[model samples]
Target: MPQLTLYGYYKSSCTTRLRIALALKKIEYTTVFIDFFNKEHRGAAYAAINPNMSLPTLAADEGDGQGPVYITQSVAALEYLEEAFPDNGVHLLPNNAADRARVRSLVEVVVADLQPRQAAQTLEKLGNDFNANQDQKVKWAYDWCIKELQAYETLVTATGLAGKYSVGDTLTLADVCLVPGIQNAVERWGVDLDKDFPALAKIYENLKAVPEVQGAHWSQQPDAPKE
Candidate 1:
């Protein structure tokens, strides 16, 4: 068994993705909540752990003489966990190289292209630096997120890669990335997934039905605000 510790905030989409991956992998982990609202992630202590001071920093014990390995960035952490615990948990990537590439391409559409543009940091910066109001911020987030989903919908339809989940029947890394992106689009930006993106709406519905995915939901996380 690997000793794993995950440091993250509840509402962060990146952190939520890691949570979904961990739950799906059936990996036992200790979670340390970093309160982003209070700027806890930017403090000196967290800075020492992750120079990037990003949410969802993962620390893992490899059982080698190298001691614990600390990883930052959501995608890198997920890939590391997949490689380290390949046999024990759900396979996140496909066996075929071409299929793996396709899966990664889908993952990138969310992780690299969509999520970053809608990140809290980016939105906050837009407000502070560009003097964007709340309505403007919402519009900016909604426009970019919807634009990306439009492209994603087209890609999935063109490639016929989606099944019960993205990129096939098995829940790959693409699903891990997709769910949280859609959640952010719906919850934060108030974009109607069902009305705007039917393909993604279907994928989101299927993903929500999975127990592990449900377990990893932002609303169910330890640090999520009580309603």
Candidate 2:
């Protein structure tokens, strides 16, 4: 079996999602730290691996004699892991179609809606183009985090699908997306999940207690800065 390698930064929520999923699925892989602070991701070497110059690119040998195939997008990489290695570990998506759709819907609440706005590139663009200050950029991220988390809370409550986890009490892709999203919001953007979104807070608390999730924490990553 060819070794799996993940190229990412510890602080990236997207990267953290992949970490959580990989851990939950019991997939063992190596990591290459891409130092975002040094602008390593924008260099020619990384661009060769991922033309988009994004963090969290997953590469693995297909054992077909072809070079490793790389999955650039986090969500796409997750689905690839599920389909390609179904029997290896825990399933992140539900078996049923409706439940699957519900999980995907919740995933987009964080990936599509919230993540893009709070990404470093987005904040940098705001500063460069609009002359927005640090406080303003933080405000931009904070507002979106609150709005999206509130939407997530409302969706879970209204659908009644949430029991112990995001969908049907199982640790699905939705929870994988939620934990890191909330982490970025609370740690970077200063949104209090426990105070403003109690439902999500409770779920997050439970999810964090899981050994897989705890092991995948950003602080536990090899690239994370030491305190």
Top candidate when judged by TM-score against the true structure: 2
Report lDDT (Cα) of residue 100, candidate 1: 94
Per-model CA lDDT versus the true structure: 0.89, 0.92
In terms of lDDT, which candidate is strongest? 2
TM-score list, all predictions: 0.96, 0.97
How much does candidate 1 score in TM-score? 0.96
Per-residue lDDT tens digits for candidate 1, residues 117-145, read 98888989999999999999999999999
lDDT value, residue 212 of candidate 2: 86
lDDT of 2 by residue, 1-227 (tens): 55689999988899989999988888888899999999999999999999999988999887888989998999998998898889878999999999999999999999999999999999999999999999999999999999999999999988798789988778999999999999999999999888999889889989989998888888898778899
For model 2, the stretches where C-alpha displacement exceeds 4 angstroms are none
Over 4 Å off in model 1, which ranges? none
What is the Å distance of residue 26 in model 2 from its true position?
Answer: 0.8
Give the root-mean-square deviation of each candidate in angstroms. 1.2, 1.0
